[model samples]
Target: MTHSEMITVLSQRLRWPEEKVSELLSVATEVIGDQLSEPGTLSLPGLGNFTSRKSKEFISLHPETGERYLIPPSIDLFFRVAPALKKQFEEREEE
Candidate 1:
């Protein structure tokens, strides 16, 4: 859902003001970003695991032009779904 839609849903469910939910989401986003930048992992139960890994530099070749390029190493973020969440999707698909 969109940010506003999420805020509305969370506000209604938690009985909190939209402004408060917005701020909470903003803070959570910032915290997640900061943790990922440290090349760390964050695991939330029933959700998934978030991780950051550094990729090694590599060389790439252009098939058509026969040109070679150097690719710089970078940090990549990944998410692995929790088993329970995956199972829920599988059951939904079977229905």
Candidate 2:
């Protein structure tokens, strides 16, 4: 869902104001980004783990032009879903 939609849902569920929910989400993302930049993992109990890693530089070929180029190394972020959450999704799909 969109950011506004998520804020609306969170405000209703937490009995918080929309503005407050929005601020919370903003701070949360900032914190997550900061942690990821540190190359650390952030774990949420029922959600999963978020981690970041640096990938090595690689060479790439342009198929159409047959030109070769060097791709710079970069940091990649990834999320792994919690086992319980995965099971819940699997059950829903089976229904």
Candidate 3:
């Protein structure tokens, strides 16, 4: 969902002012980003872990021209869903 929608949901759920929720959301996002800049994993028990690592540079084939091009490497962010959360989605899909 978009940031505004998230703020609205949090405000309603927490009974907090929209402005306060917005500020908290902004701070939380900035903190998460700052933490990820270093090499480490940030874990939220019921959600998942967030981590980053350098990706290997690779060559890509241009479909239109059949020409090969080099794709530069960059930091890759990863999130592995918690087992419980994955199971919930899987069970729902079975219905």
lDDT tens string, model 1, 1-95? 98799899999999999999999899999988888887778999999999999888999999999999999998899999999999998888542
Candidate 1: list runs displaced more than 4 Å.
89-95
lDDT of 3 by residue, 1-93 (tens): 987998899999999999999998889899999888776788988899998887889999989999999999877789989988888887885
Best by lDDT: 1
RMSD of each: 2.1, 2.4, 3.4
Q: Which residue pairs does candidate 1 place in steric collision?
A: none
Give the top-scoring candidate (TM-score): 1
Query: Candidate 3: where are CA atoms >4 Å away?
Result: 55-74, 93-95
> What lDDT score belongs to each candidate, Candidate 1 first?
0.92, 0.90, 0.88
Q: Between candidates 1 and 2, name the one with more favorable TM-score.
A: 1
lDDT of 2 by residue, 56-92 (tens): 9999999999999999998899999999899888888
TM-score for each prediction? 0.81, 0.78, 0.72
C-alpha positional error of residue 41 in candidate 1 after TM-score superposition, expressed in Å = 2.2
Error of model 1, residue 49, in angstroms:
0.7
Looking at model 3, report the run of 10 residues with the lowest lDDT sum: 86-95
